[model samples]
Every structure is written in structure tokens, then in C-alpha cells.
Target: MSPNPAPRPSASDTPPRRRSVQCAGPHGLHRMSYLEWGDADNPDVLVCVHGLTRNGRDFDELARAMAPHYRVVCPDVVGRGLSSWLPVKTDYQLPTYVADMITLIARLDVDSVHWVGTSMGGLIGMLIASIPDNPIRRLVLNDVGPVVTAASLARIGQYVGMAPVFPHFEAAEAYIRAVSAPFGHLSDAQWRQLTESSVKAVDGGWAMRYDPGIGEPFRQTPLLEDVSLWPIYDAIGCPTLLVRGAESDLLTRETADEMGRRGPRARLVEVPGVGHAPTLMDAGQIAPVRDFLLAAGAAGGGR
Candidate 1:
């Protein structure tokens, strides 16, 4: 008998398309680079936003998987990734992010969009989508909620403000892996991608993509036991999905439950063996998002 042929990869396994768009920022016009996959003309637009320290590249695998039907746009929020960092770190707040996103939406010339956000990105979506004339038709909040935990905030603050210099990419990657253990079980390739997108070669060493001063506002801010934004979430009118890593220190089980019970009554999913956030790279992780977006698109007239 002839040897069995090798299995062919499915379309969903293919790589994503990439592109960059310039968006107006506080200081002149800056290029807000994005990874665009699927047909440019597709009315079904899904915008994926990354976490505080992460860039748009975090959604590469997820975007590739969803490209068959949706135009997946993953933007490097200002001050992160290939996007230009703000000269004034104080401007690195949600209002600025929301404004930049508005500019991006206008540039796309779309009526509305489906939003998927992780951690800090989730907060931006929650704030923007809650507006009276918001353009987000459906929302996905990954590992974040209206009430942020002090413990998680403290943990993030510990590192967010620190500027680290690494002798090489290996060292930088190792450091990232150590701190990002809460993300859980990423493959060697995935880890490498994260490292590459997060660090840049500077002189003889490697450093993070963001401005270290960006964290100054966080440090200068007052600490509180609980910071509530239930009003903002309640204002959201779109269908919403919430994903929480089972062991996440950030989005507590209580918060996730409350998120479902109140405020948009978001559909909730929990990923095992992960914490803080889900990267949406794995099939198991990406499936819920794909399903959610499809349903949202169908309901929102392909917004």
C-alpha cells in the first residue's frame, strides 16, 4: 500500500494579512500600524485591542483564524507597538485611546464595528461602546471588569513603571516569559512572537516597545481598594462577551459573575490553565471569539 499523504492545513490555519494606517494624534499625525486580514471591503469588521504593555501583534493568530468572514483589524494602540509613543506620558489615558479609535473608525469609513479587547483595551472598549452614539455594535471584554482589583493593580504597577535594559533578545524574552506566566502555556513560537513584538534593539541591548514614562501616571495615581465603573458598563447597549482566565488575578471570579448578572449581561467564558487574559491564539480560545463575532455581525447587519 502507498504511504498516507500528509494532512493539508485548513484555511483557518493560514497566516493573516498585515497593513498600517495613519491616525491623527495629539502631536501631529502619527502612523497607527495595524494588522488587517480578510477582504478590505468586508462590512463585517472586528477590531481587536491588546493589553497595557502588549501591541496589536497579539491578535495575529486570532485574526488569521477569523479572516474568512470578518475584516480583522488589530491596532497597536498609541504608545505601544510600532505606533508612535506620546511625548506627554500623561496623555496616555483612555480618552486619548478612544479618540484615536474614533479616527481609525472614520478612516475605515464604517458605520460600526465589533470590538474585542484584553485588559486595558477592554476598559477602552467599555468606555467607548457605552457612549450614546458609540460605533461598537458588539463587545468582548477579556480578563477585565468594571471593578479592578487592588492586588492586580499593584502587581501591574510594580513592573509597568520599571524600565529594564536587557543585554539581548534572549534575556528580554526570558524576562517577559517569567512575568507573563499568568498568561499560561504559550508555545515556543508564540513566546518568540511575543518577544519580537514587545522588544526593540537599542544600541547594544533590547528594550520594551513602550515609553517607560507611560507608567508614570499609574504611579502618580492614588490607590484604592476598589475602583468601580459600573455606570460606564451599564451604559453599553451592544451584545457583549466576557472571557476570564480561570486563575486570573485581575478579573476575579466574583467580578466575572457580577459582569454577567449586571451591566450588559455579558456572555462569559473561562479558559483553563490561564490567568489575567486569554491571547486568543489557541483553537479552543479563539472559537468563542469567532462564534461571538459571527453572531454579533449577523445581528448588527454586518457592522
Candidate 2:
């Protein structure tokens, strides 16, 4: 008898569609790349955005798990991933990011979407969700909040635009492992996935896939104290869920507590032993998010 043929991958296991849409910025129009998974006609949409210096691929596992229930769309957010770089570096701020998302949503032809944003991505979600009649119906602020500590800002500033070129792929992986230690104990395969998607082959060596100029606007501003956006947080009316690394320095326990008490009054979940942020790769980390987003009547009130 002939050997059994290789099994075909399941729908959720299949790769997502690589798509792009043009977005207007301060200088001109720029291309934003995104990954789409699940039923193209499914109107139940989930928009997952990555943190600063990261890309849409960060949500690969989460998207796969969620694709069965919702149409998952993860964007590279302007300067990162396969997206175009802005000619004006200062345009890398939240306003430009929010506008780009709006354009992406229009292209998707969706009336509303559920948002899962990590760090900088979370801030963008907060801004978009705060708008009157905005498209975001449910929000997941992963390991971030309206209040960000100055120390964490300093830590992130140290390397946002370093633009280092590695001699080999291993070197690039090592660098990612070092900086992303707070991602909390990922396996070798997981680490490889993160590194491969984060770097690109250049003339001399491998380099990060983002524009170095993306850091210009951030470095120009001095962070003297904790960055607080209570007004923005207060403006949001949709259901919000807040996930924090238990030992995170960026989003303190105190701030997360207050976040539960006010506007949108997000329900909080903490991943033990992690710091800075949770990668949401493993089953444990993905459960709360999946549950919250898939739960019935999540729009009425947070769980």
C-alpha cells in the first residue's frame, strides 16, 4: 500500500492573506500591510495591533485560535512589518496611527471591530475607541494602560531606533531575546518565530524591519514623569479588558486598579511571573482574551 499522504492543514492552521491599503499621512499617502484570517465574508471582525518595534505577526497564534470564531485582521501599523515608512518621522505619533487604522477599517468594509493592542497599539485603540461613534466595539489593552511610567519609557527609548545590523540570523535572534526577555519564557521555536518576523536581510547584514526614523518623534520629547491620559481613558464607552504582566513596570498595579474603577472600567487579568508585557502566544495567556471577546453580550459590560 502507498504511504499515507501528508495531512492537509486545518483552516485555522493555514496562513493568513497578506493585504495592504493606502493611508493618508502628513506628507502623502503610504501603504499599510495587514494579515487577514478566517472567512472573508465574516462581519465579526477582530483587529490586533502590535507594540512599538513589533509587527502584526506577533499575533499569529492568537489569530489562529480566534479565526474559527471571528475574522481576524492584524496590521503592521505604518512603519513596521511590510508597511511603508513615513517621510515625516514626527508623523509616527498616535494621531497618524489612529488615522491609518480608520482608513484600514474603511477598506475592510466593516461597521465595527474588536481591538487587541499591545503597548503603543493599546494607546491607539484607546484613542480610537474614545471617539464618538468609533468603529471599535470591544477593546483589549494588553500589558498597557493610560498611565505609563517614566522608567519604562526610558528603557524603551534606549533602543527604539538603534537600527543595528547583525552579522548573522543568530545574532539578530540573540538581540531580540535580550530585549524581549519581558515577553516571558518563550520556547526556541517561539523565539525563532519572533526573530524571523522582526528582521530582514539587508546588503551588509540582517536589520530590524522597521524604519529607524520612527523613533525621532519619541526621542524629541522628554519624559519627566509618568505619562497619564486619564481623559482619553475616560472617554471610551465600549467594553474594555486590561491584561498586565504581574511584575510589569510599564503598567503598575495601582494604575490597573484605578483603570477598573473608571470609564469603561476595564476588567483586569494578570499573568504571573511576567513583566513589561505578555506575548499571548501560549494557551494560558490566550484564554482570557478569547473568552472575553467571544463571550455573549461583552458590549453590555465587562466580565
Candidate 3:
């Protein structure tokens, strides 16, 4: 079946609001920044989380398309984007990330939420949704699953925190394009947008916005084999949808099939030509997420 057409945000709708909340961590607290779009009063909320190294701004196109129907929230997971870095680099683990999200949700003052998580974000969502009586009414895992291959992990480790400073903006854009080639074909404007949000001006030139130390944990723990979370995947009971990149090296077709047969029995969709993850910046990618979150019987539907 074809994807449902996404509605464009109306002219009168206001732009997203930049906000932050102090979240408790292993050491004291740190601020987690997020962008809020659509009606502040709207109870129906959709939280879109980005991949491992990317920030919330990656969802700008998707957020704008869904803002017309739901209050869209995009968060810069701690240690990425505008969010503050951890006092201890190793604190970048999922436990810290999950705790921070709990604080963010409490601040939202909502009983339930719909989630769209990409790659690392999907893993976070899986753990949360697996909990008994999780607030996530529906979940969308974009190009990631319970089993993460060691080969893919090794590939990402090669550059997760090794970006170099560029003397000019063009250089930065080129670097982003080369490293993110797996995101598939994106428009020139889209590439520029990614570059703009990813870097900040430094004394010598432009540098990555995230803390380089965030890669410490990955370097410390070398994966000998695939990491599996089948127990967590089977614990989730909410409605779910899984989007996979046809050529993805991370979430294999075999694992995705198992996901569909167990737990919430997620409906699966694969985007051809993409790998690792699919940046939900276009209509084709955004429609499946929108339809799954807005479908009848979905939590916070028709609000």
C-alpha cells in the first residue's frame, strides 16, 4: 500500500519554540534542549528522536509536515545538538539517555505520547516501550532493531567523534555528505540544512557541535559479536511500526522479520537504496510515520 499523503503546515502556524529542561544525571544535572512545534495546548504529542550522531534538527521537514495534526517535539538527546555534555564521557550510555527522556516527558505534562525513533533513538524507545504500562501509545523504529551487528558498530566507531575542523563551510558540508552518504539521496538544500545544524564556528574554523568525548564509551567497549535485545523487543505490547532501509547494514531483513512476528507485531516498511537509517526529511518517509501515529485506535488519535 502507498503511504498516506502528509498535510503541509498552514501559513498561520507559528514556528517551533526552542526550550530546555534540567535533567538529573550520574553527576548533578545537565540541560536537555528540545524544539516544540504546533499548539502548546494540544494534548496529542509526537516525539521524534534522531540517530546516534545527529541532532533533533534532522527532523525539521518531518516535524513541519506533522505539526498540522499533532504537537511535534524534537529533542537534542543529551551530548548532541544544543544539549549540554555529560561531566563524565562514559555517562553517554542508554541509562542516562533514558532517564533524561523521563524528565522531558514529565515536563510535557502528558499521560501518553507517540514516538518516532531513528537508529540509537529506536533502541532507547524499545527499552522504554518494553516497560510495563509505558506511556508510549505507539512506536516507530526507523532502521534499527534489537540486534545490532558488531560490524556496523565498528563502522560507526571509525568517525563518531573524529570529525575535523574545516576552514570553510563548504568543507564541512562535504564532510557531512561523505560520512552520511548512507542517508541516501537528499536535496542540495537538505544537505546544507544538515551541515548548518551540525557545526559551529570555532577559533580556527568550524567544528562539530557535539562533544568529541561522547565517543569514549564506544571506544572503551569493543563489541565482539552482535548485541541482541530480543527480550526487550518481546516485552513491548503497544502498536508498533518498523521502517528499514533496504540496503541497511545495521538492522538486517532477518531481524526485522522477527520483530514483525513477535511483541506488538510491528508493521514493516523498507525504503530502497537507503542504508543504516532513513532521514525522515521527505514525504515518502514522513507519510508512514504519520499514518501509524494518526491511525484509528492509536493513542491520542483524533484529538
Candidate 4:
């Protein structure tokens, strides 16, 4: 018999390349950069977005694990990472983000996509997936929901947008760790990666990778409990997974449970010994997300 054909290589082994695409904004047009992994021609796509201040590299572990199955795209969410900063700083808002994502999906030229969003990223996914003609098939909302606690908002506002200059990488890393302790149970390497992706060397020394001006719009708006996104959340019909950290201050257990009872009737998974969100940097966290997205695809509109 002929020797067994060589096994197909895993896409995880392929390093991602920085790709730029133009996006429209109220002021005009801006460029959004992303890390592309897996086969460029692959139709199955997965888009992972990071938290408020994080960059595309946050999904490095998850992308590597799922690259074998999907063309994983992780975006820097303009104003952060390698993407272009908006000329009008105050234009940063959910609506702007959703529009940029639309531009991104158009560039991908895919039939449908699976989405994973953490915190602010999750809010963007909710808005996009809610649109009647949108292409999001499966969505993973990581540690966020319609309701945001005032305490959480207060805590987040205390530091967001403040780009305190750091004398060295170690000092910046330490700051990240202090502010991000709510992330819970991250390895030293993971923390380092988070720090590296979050900062860059400025003329004087070092500062955050994201534009501090993004906070302009945030400061103007209040994240009150009364600011209900239930209407938007109810509009999304895609199969959804609500992943909450057990000790989360942002997404409470009540809200996570209510999400299961309405709208998409999302399946819920609460990660123990964590708060705010799970980093998904390890096997245990990655497994649930992988299973939910892939199995949902296999179901063929089973939801």
C-alpha cells in the first residue's frame, strides 16, 4: 500500500500577519489593523475582540487553538494596538465601533462568522448580531451583559484613559498587574504579554498603546443601570454563550441568569475563582468557548 499521505499542518503553527483595512467614521475614514491567522481562503471565520484598553494580542492563545478550524481574526479596535487613531477623539462610542466592525466583516468577504467579545467588545458584538441582515452566526459574550454595575463602572473609570508614563517596561507591567488584578488567575507570562501589547515606548519613556482620547466619549457618558440595552440584547437571534466570572463585578449572576431566560436564551458558564472576566489564555478557559462555537456550527441552526 502507498505510504500514508502527510498529515495536514495545523494553522496554529502559522504566525499572524498585521493587515490593515479602511473603515468609515463620522468625521471621515480611518484604518483598522488586525492580526490574521489560518488560511486566507478559509470561509469559516472567527473574530475575537478585546476589552476596553486591550489590543488584538489578547486572543493569542484562543486563536492558536482554534486556527485549525477557522480563519481567526483578532482586531486592534482602532485607536488601540497598530490601528490608526481617530482624528476626532470624542467619536469613540459603541455606534462607531459597530460601524468599524461592519467595514472589517466586508473586507473578510465571508458568508458568516463566529464572534468572541470581552467587556466593551461584547457590547459591540451584541449590537452587530442584533441587526436583521448581519452575518454573525454564533456569539460568545465574555463577562458582560445588558446591565453594568455602578461599582464596576466607577472602578473602571478610576484608571481608564489615564496613560501614566512609565520609566521602564517593568514599571508599566507592574501597573497593568495592579489595575488588572480583577482578571484573576493569570500566569506570569500571560501578564507579561498583556503588558507588552498594552504599551509602547514614547519619546520620553513609555505609555499605553491606546489613544487616551478614546476616554473622552466615555467620560461624557454615564454607565448607569437605567441605560438599558435590553432592547438591543433582545434583538439578537443568534445562538449565544454567556461566560461570566463567578466573582465578576461587571456581569452579575442575576443578569447572566436572566440572559438565559430571554432573547437568545444564551447558555451560561461561570468560571470559578475569577472576577470581571476570564483571560482564556489557558486550556481550561479555551475549551468551553471552542466547544460552544464549533458545536453550534455543527448543529446547523439547531438553536
Higher-lDDT candidate of 1 and 2: 2
Residue by residue across 1-303, what tens digits does model 4's lDDT show? 001112225777999878989998999988999999887777778899998888899999999988887788999998999998998988888888999998899899876788999999999999998898788888999999988788888777778898689999999999999999988988898899999888999977789999888877757776665346888899988889999999999898988999999999999998999998899888988999988877723324325
> What C-alpha lDDT do the candidate models reach, one value each?
0.82, 0.89, 0.87, 0.86
lDDT of 3 by residue, 1-303 (tens): 011223345711778999999999998889999999887777777888888899999888888877876778899999999999988999999989888888898999988888899998999898998887678878999999999999899999999999999999999999999999999999999999999999999988999989998888989998989999999998888888999999999999999999889877889999999997899888999888878777766773221
Question: Residue 89's C-alpha lDDT in candidate 1?
Answer: 82
lDDT of 4 at 243: 92
Model 4 gets an lDDT of 0.86
Error of 3 at 234 (Å): 0.4
Worst 10 residues of 2 by lDDT: 1-10
TM-score of 2: 0.95
Off by over 4 Å in 4: 1-8, 223-226, 296-299
Runs in model 2 deviating more than 4 A are 1-10, 299-303
Clashes of each: 0, 0, 0, 0
| Model 3 regions more than 4 Å off | 1-12, 300-303
Model 2: lDDT to the true structure: 0.89
Order of quality (lDDT): 2, 3, 4, 1
lDDT of 2 by residue, 190-274 (tens): 9999999999999888999999988887699979899999999999988899999999989999999999999899999999999
Which is the winner by lDDT between candidate 3 and candidate 4?
3
Return whichever of 1 and 3 wins on TM-score. 3
